[model samples]
Target: MMNSPVETIFYIIDETATILQEELSCTYLEAVAETGENLFQDDILQDEVSEVTKKRLQKSYEEANIGEQPNETIRKAFQFAILKGMKENVQPNHQMTPDSLGLFISFLVNKFITTEKQLTVLDPAIGTGNLLTTVLNQMANSNVHSIGVEIDEVLIKLAYVGANLQKHQLELFNQDSLEPLFIDPVDLVLSDLPIGYYPNDVRAQDYELQAKEGHSFAHHLFIEQSIKHTKGGGYLFFIVPNGLFESTQSQQLHEYLHKEVHIQGMLQLPTSLFKNEKAGKSILILQKKKEGIKPPKEILLATLPSLMKQSAVEDILAKIDGWIKQNK
Candidate 1:
């Protein structure tokens, strides 16, 4: 029996990446990035690798035909490769948002922005571009302009390669996301926000959510930056910690949200998604303030069932649909 498209693509990626890793004496993830770039360009760009290894890589690439695979299939295969690479060199911020959660967020984005014919979306913490591309693939609007920002060079390189492989024209910036963005305000913003204190106290001072006397929460600053880059009445969806509003600096966050945006909803993700209860997170929905826009009559709130339970997930989605219809 023939291997499925996802498995085939993943095999090609892994095989070529391993060959590159051995030849270049580089890490698995770096080799994966190189492999993805080669796939996208449809040529081996590396001169350092031996001719023997190059011929092996060329042979592997020729065996797999990924040109006809669906975008999601390609994305999923690349995601699996990235997940494997991450395990080999575990970094705290190198996590990819799970596929189920990415799909859930995509649903919300499509439902909320149904009326728009064109859209621009931004992801400030676009690690490897997995979550951003996932949402982009599911967007109702075909005419979308997307931007992604990440500070790490390797991660951004991976994101660039993945976006190219998926045929997404993403405007990716490799810089500290909190630094001033040169782009115009976008229609929507999304992020699986990086948690923990931002080390640069001086840069943190520029944000309204900055702590009065210490390093500010990176997640809090991300929310502020996302809002800043969003057009008035535009929407922002964030995957945030469950205790986002209960932190020691919650008051500042509360005050900031009250003044600049309207809290549209909060849906606690299934506890089963996390390693422990303490690590669980929620999807936070917010809309930037505008002169005519009003808060939803009732903020949509619910704890999602385990995504593995298909029937329970459908029921929750139905309830959400009803809420959206009534509110709209």
Candidate 2:
């Protein structure tokens, strides 16, 4: 219940003990200690650690009231990093970042959504349940069945455990995301993707585009498939680097998106929220609109607040709620 980041981080270590063993393969004492040390060692992790604690203070987040907090976030990062550390197949460079995990949670809560009655949510790379757990937390304890396609069995197990801890009814499969998503009509929660320079099985059925992280590969295609499952006005949220906003190569995708999908909102998130030491990281919030309705002439553009701090998260939720209410 303490406000201090160190204390809050430790608090989550305590809160998730049972599930870590049962689901994510982390024993409380061992994993927590290991992760804290690794976080300190990694220069990228070190750079953001101070802002982490300061941001908690800035947000005035209630350690006790919030069902889950950033501490869980830090732990998930450790778990993912360590798991990657042990595996040669998955690169250590691109574990799902903690702050983006938090932002994913923010986007879900801000929407209060379940935007479509029939469509389900999916995460192809669901490394250790960062996105799924966040989605579970926002469901108001309701069972929203979601599917996670992860090549790592360990992460699939982690997602299973994390979902269970929150009592979220979910299905997790160890599969590659690039292959066709058989679970059609599913909206996606895309987090940190494998960038080109990073290590990943290039031969994996779903992998392509070596220049950028696997983040840009077939994402729009996935969006198109999601439309089959997504009802009109259903929302799709993806975390893409800043380059996507200004890239010349992406003009085709952007044009395709505007030509077909209705624009809901585009948010440029802060850089510190990233897991890796990279130049650009952002959250893209998109809404699936009905076919034939003219898309909004002016896309709603928001410069997202720093996700490291709690106040930033709450402020984002408040504004999004205001937007939905105004439109509704």
Candidate 3:
């Protein structure tokens, strides 16, 4: 919330970022390529939020008398403040992940995470890095390595700050995920695929070559990319618009999954669960087929009403967990 008469802008950024990271951990580094008018220029906002930066940040926190509030309360206040300030004072361009949806997806995937020494998770369009951070929070474990690829500079900066503040080891990149990219394939691929269409001309010539023309949604391209970058036998949890299941554009994707991947489950999310958007969403869980293994013939699919509670979501996941165990 930079709009408030904050004597120090760094303070708001620092405090609000605490929610993204755990307390007193040094597992990340924050990088912002440039500064905006609302955040001051390079003269004030520089490469890192180090001890010197905190001194400036602390002054504003003291002025606001935020020393007495618990970290959670402060985090909530700071999140709203930044969100409001960004909307009212600064230009709006990015979408933030809702806390409930972030946590819900994380909760659904928790059981699948393991103590494997080389676990790696990737989020191709990691806006603000909330979903990945939420996954780490739910696990409350530090053994996993996380990575995110984002195109927006500002969102990646915020994500880097949050990952560092939480003391979680994260690798962040600012690049177009739709283009030809190189990263070692990972074990788990998680994403809230950004909505919209990619330009037919700019899209890589051979991207998902099987998809026909006039079927050029960005989300479809991203899903294809995620599948390519996922290890055999690894898993993917994508929160995509429900339209993917019905759209003719996604016919190629459906065919590919039917032949090469096992549809673990699909959990329909509440409509309007995401702020500022009207598309119905669902979490599609899939596992890449290892060599010599055939895809499962049956899939587990369920829907939750818009009015369902957190506990109810948990119950539904528990049922899905049981099914996974039986089928595995």
Candidate 4:
């Protein structure tokens, strides 16, 4: 038994993840990922358990004392634990997007993703769902819908808990995003595309990317897929590693993007933006091309300093708003 709900939630998640990993004979990351799927039955509630994994998951949830009531604080604790666990226990190569930057990107992207009906947002790599949730909350509209697909099991589960507690509806999937058969095209797409190369399997082959064999980064492949899944004239805002631009293999992708989409904006984020100082980041805002649409004469390009204050971000958003109006 734990003293507080926060402590209990964290302990249960950690212990369960570790136990599952040991039992399944996989990495700790794989175990953490499986924990979420095991807990949730229908993507919303914790009922409908599979017989094999039910005992372990039930014991953890019961120990945590997650009652019928949706405790917002507890849900937040769950999300925090997931983020913390990934940072401390997982390989140093993996990183979660910081909340400050997530909020900044969400608010900045919100201005351009407007719709008469509800705004539909899709995040291809919605680790823990913080970025998507933040974006939705800031939109200040009740009619918005968010869809996220993540490969990380634990992160997706934590994201589901957060959305449920906040009373927000979301479509989340714990599967390989590179697989065929995509969700309906959405009004806007937002994500922190994971960095690194993917095995050139059938899914990679299906993308038919212009890059040579073994050169495809998961981020670039997701960029292509996200563009394909976005409606014509819809917007996509993703954080990508800056090194991608300088790679020779990326030239083919650059050419394809030039032919297919409008480069609305690019922000060179400081290397210090993430915990890993060696990893440089940049924001890419692209608008899918409609049949008769032409690329804008001027694309907004700016560099953000290492330490950006909220006021400075507001100023940037103002400029982006002006650009959107001019282009529209």
On lDDT, the candidate that comes out on top is 1
TM-score on alpha carbons, each prediction:
0.98, 0.61, 0.75, 0.75
lDDT of 1 at 64: 65
State how far residue 145 of model 3 sits from its true place (Å). 1.5
lDDT of 4 by residue, 179-290 (tens): 7636899888998888778775556777746357655777778998898899998889999887767876678778879877998878888666665856778889899999
By summed lDDT, the worst window of 10 consecutive residues in model 4 runs over 40-49
Give the true-structure RMSD of model 3: 7.6
How many steric clashes between backbone atoms does each model show?
0, 9, 4, 2
1-328: candidate 2 lDDT, tens digit per residue? 4366435544544443322333335554334333333323321222323555434432332333333535355445434433443353454532655546554655554464644453366665677666556555545534356777777665565555555544456777677555566665654444445434223335333322322444344444444444445556566676666776466446656766665566666677665655554656655666666766555445556776665578977887787777766654
Clashing pairs in 4: 33-153, 33-154
After superposing candidate 4 on the true structure, give the runs of residues whose Cα lies further than 4 Å from its correct spot. Answer: 1-76, 92-94, 275-277, 306-311
lDDT of 4 at 114: 58
Q: What lDDT is reached at residue 212 by model 1?
A: 84
lDDT of each: 0.92, 0.52, 0.66, 0.72
Stretches off by above 4 angstroms in model 2 are 1-90, 99-119, 187-192, 197-232, 275-278, 292-294, 307-319, 326-328
RMSD of each candidate? 1.0, 11.1, 7.6, 5.4
User: Can you give the lDDT of residue 203 in candidate 1?
Assistant: 94
